[model samples]
Target: MAGTETHYTLPRPTFDEAPKLLIVVAPYYKDIADDLIAGAKAEIEAAGATWEIVEVPGALEVPTAIRIADRTADFDGYVALGCVIRGETTHYETVCNDSSRALSTLGLAGLCIGNGILTVENRDQAVVRAAVDQQNKGGGAAAAALHLIALGRKWTGGEKQVGFRPVGA
Candidate 1:
């Protein structure tokens, strides 16, 4: 079973300056979301990073929230948390695909985002994944964001240079 499988987790990243992350959560599933938040917060703190959170209505809105924050806020990275359990209708696929795609698009555009939104066949799967002591997908997501932030800082040397510059000037 997946619960019994072992996976290698990357060591928590280190930084010269602590990163400030914005956690955007979709609290459609209150209990599940809370557990996810707990795990993510623990991971963020463990890495000597700081975080602030904002809630959106559902999974689909999580990416939009992150995009807005990236444009108008000063966060170094973002953690996206939510739960989407399959239901009787086709809404599950739409929510799952669109949200995942948007988050990926933003990531490709150089936004450091950890996507923790769970798309499960049932509530039981979500519960297991969200549990802080179990799968802890939330923590995994935070670690991903932190690693990306570390990489970004390393490559850019913490500088943002816009516009064209002469090569070997």
Candidate 2:
């Protein structure tokens, strides 16, 4: 008699088990913003967790939203989505730099805000990057959030095996 083989599957942690997620998006580039939102929503829902979308006037306003959102509740993580294309003026640089800096501060404070903002040379590139493709940055941002959230949980001892010892116990 031939024996049947069974494949073992690893259980995927459900999103409901995590804290919560907030997605903050900049509406300056509405088209690209739409792309980022679409991708982000897919990932969030696929994880089986709740997600809220907040809009900012422009890239300059993303960090503030993140800060306020982070403080309001215990979010599992956050995703900051924006697209800034370089123009003939230096205004592009300023917005990109300032927003990046502000978000970095929040992350350092353990906000777990995913920096999915794209600073592209042109609208075409930004659109391509934001699309749901290999270059889809929205997914990348969500992944970062997931990783950070898990890291935080581990550091805070979310795992049950943290204090486990050998059979000698």
Candidate 3:
């Protein structure tokens, strides 16, 4: 069974300079959000990184807040945390897709973002995922962001200018 399978986790990364990260959370489910935040914060601190937290209304706002921070804040990375339990309506799909898309777009645009938003069938699944003793999705997300930040730093000196060059003057 998938549940009995062992998952391979990447080795935790170390950094010469402490990375600063912003954690944006949608606390629609307060308990779950709190658990996620705890896990994420622990992971960040374990990596010798600093982080700040901001609360949004719901899952949809998590990415939006991250984008805003990316534009105005000096954080090296961002962690997006939230839970979206499937309901009777189609709102679940909309929230999941849009939030995921926005985060992906921002990541592609050069922002280091860890997306921990949970889209599960019920609260039980969310609880397990958020628990630090369990899946610890929050920690997984933070680790992802840290890895991306490391990659970004690794390539910083090799950045090439890309744009149209006025017809080779």
Candidate 4:
């Protein structure tokens, strides 16, 4: 038999110092939402940051909460969690498109939003994706925030910290 190949896994990124995290959640799918929040909290804690959770009505409200939170300059970054399952009408498309756009605009302005708003076809898919697995999207979003912050530090001449406090606020 041929020898089996082995692969080495890398360690998760650790901050030089822990930063604060603001989490915005849309409780459309309670089960999925709870799971996502748990995964995100665990990752944030592991990275040595304090985390706070805020609840909104549903996916339609996530981006707005993120934008509002962005105005505060309170946390280093943010994570948005919600589930949008497609239906017969195009309402799903509209929500997904709009939410994604708003989040991107916030990110461009130096507010790192994880954008974990799940647009799945059904509840089962949402459940499977939100938990503490290797592919947990919530955990992935938390990691995204951490990575973006690191990249920001590189770009800002070693400033290493950025608060929201959007202009004209």
lDDT per residue (tens digit) for residues 85-155 in model 4: 99999999998998888888889888877878889887777877787763477877777776676667557
Query: Residue-pair clashes per candidate, as listed?
Result: 0, 1, 0, 1
Q: What is the C-alpha RMSD of each candidate to the true structure, in Å?
A: 2.4, 10.4, 1.4, 7.0
- Clash pairs for candidate 2: 20-76
- lDDT agreement with native, every candidate: 0.95, 0.79, 0.92, 0.79
Over the stretch 34-153, how does candidate 3's per-residue lDDT look in tens digits? 999999999999999999999999999888899889789799999999999999999999999999999999999999999999999999889989999888999999999999999999
Q: Is candidate 3 or candidate 4 better by lDDT?
A: 3
TM-score of every candidate relative to the true structure: 0.93, 0.80, 0.95, 0.82
Clashes of 3: 0
**Which stretches of candidate 1 lie above 4 Å from their native place?**
157-169
Q: After superposition, how far is residue 159 of candidate 3 from its true place, in Å?
A: 1.8
- Name the TM-score of candidate 1: 0.93
The numbered model that scores best in lDDT is 1
Ranking by lDDT: 1, 3, 4, 2
